[model samples]
Target: MHLLLVGPPGAGKGTQAKRLAKKYSIPHVATGDIFREAIKNETPLGKKAKEYIDQGKLVPDEVTVGMVEERLSRDDCQKGIILDGFPRSVDQANALSDILQDLELALDAVVNIDVGDEEVINRLSGRRVCSECGASFHVEFNPPQDAGVCDECGGELYQRDDDNPETIKERLVVYSEQTSPLIEYYQERDLLLVIDGETTPEQVFERIEKELDALE
Candidate 1:
């Protein structure tokens, strides 16, 4: 099933995407991961993306579309792919539609894990990470055994600047401005699945599983 998962920063869409990909034997393709790999390897597309990244500018759609086109054509995607982050704007969504239409691949669904503004703020603001091992913990959900410390690596957990309330609020604003239309676009096509995102991560994944099962 070719799928798209859309949600706010703290929506846990990534975790659910991973689980759904594993269950359905599809590649979980995240734009950030793709960019990191491309930029680290310095591919032609990566070079283009890096010019924007180095200048603190967003990578243009042409460059991103090219890289994604290359990725989706791979043999593994014969099954399908779960897209985590891409098509932030309606223009990109149209571009994706063009690509998929040309490839003759149908999108199964577009899922939105919907959590409200205050809940999103609280969830993200309380997030902390282990810098050394990249382990994520929340003050509320899964606190480390030692307060502000990682039990496995003995590393101090620190809140990321991006997780700050002000920054996260700005991100949500940008997301709403850029992605709301895309959400509506898919909704009109009768492909949007809205899931309550305030639930536990396990429950969220279970909900995604049920949605995908119904689609099948």
Candidate 2:
């Protein structure tokens, strides 16, 4: 079940990634997680990544690709792995193809969860987080007992700066620009599986499972 999960921000991609990984008994190889691990362990590639991250710059493709290659080369990845958050651009996609070729493995599918820009804006902008416990809530979907307060810890609930409507809109624009061609790239290879993301999480996972089952 070697899969690449793709979605815009607030599309529930992370949730689906965990579900698929658990169902298939494969490691969920999220790039962010791997980067943190590498940096924590002070690996060479991690050090390079940290330098760029500390400077508030994107990690160069080579460093990102190197970290990904290292991760996929692990023994646990022998059977399969679910990849999330790598290959954000077509260039990285090509790099990934090369990495897979070297490893003698190929992606079974690239699952893309699709949601409209307005829905994404609504989903992200409405989110609030607990300042103390980092608990999450949505203004509409999962509000706390009291307005702007955390139910569990009695902490103040605040919307993150990045979760502001204007910032979310800007993020959507960037996501579209970066991901459109990457989506097309996978579609050309007949490995793209587009799933409706506006539905409930279970419903969305059902659709994704149906698609992957067909592939099997």
Candidate 3:
């Protein structure tokens, strides 16, 4: 069940990926997690990535591809992996195809969690996070019992700049420009599963499970 989860920023694809990984006994491989682990352990490629990070520049695709290649080569990934936040463009998707061919592994499905623009804006703009405990909440969907406070840790809840409406719109524009073609690229291959993301997380996961089950 080698899988790729794709969605807009507030689409909750990450949550579904985690659940799918746990349920299927696969590693949940996120690009950010891979970079951090590599950098923290000071691998050769990680060192190269760090140099770019120190300069506040995006890590080169070659470096990123190398790291992903290394990760997929690991024993745990031999079973399969749930990939999140990689292959943002057609070029990267092609690189991923190459990497998989080298490893002799094929992707089973690419799940696209589809949420509308206004829905995404509402979901992200209403999001709040605990300052101390890092707990998450939403004003409309999952509000804290006490206003502006964490229910679990008594921490003050704050909105991240990235969650602002303007920032979210900008991100969606960037994502549209970069990822739309990637979606088409996969769709043409008949490996895409499009699921509505405006529903509850449980419902969304259920839909994803159904799709994966169909693949089996």
lDDT of 2 by residue, 77-149 (tens): 9899899898899999999999999999999999999998899999999999999998889999989999999
User: Per-residue alpha-carbon lDDT of model 1 for 1-216, expressed as tens digits?
Assistant: 999999888999888988888888889999998998899998999999999999999889999998887777788887899998888889889988988888888789999999998999999999999978888999998899999999779898999999999999999999999887887999999999999999998898888889889977
lDDT of 2: 0.93
Question: Scored by CA lDDT, what does every candidate get?
Answer: 0.90, 0.93, 0.95
For model 3 the local lDDT of residue 22 reads: 93
Where model 3 places Cα greater than 4 Å from the true spot, the runs are 152-154
lDDT of 3 by residue, 31-64 (tens): 9999999999999999999999999998999999
Per-model TM-score on C-alpha atoms:
0.95, 0.92, 0.93
Q: Rank the candidates by lDDT, best first.
A: 3, 2, 1
Which pairs of residues clash in candidate 3, taking residues 3 or more apart in a chain or in different chains?
A: none
Ranking by TM-score: 1, 3, 2
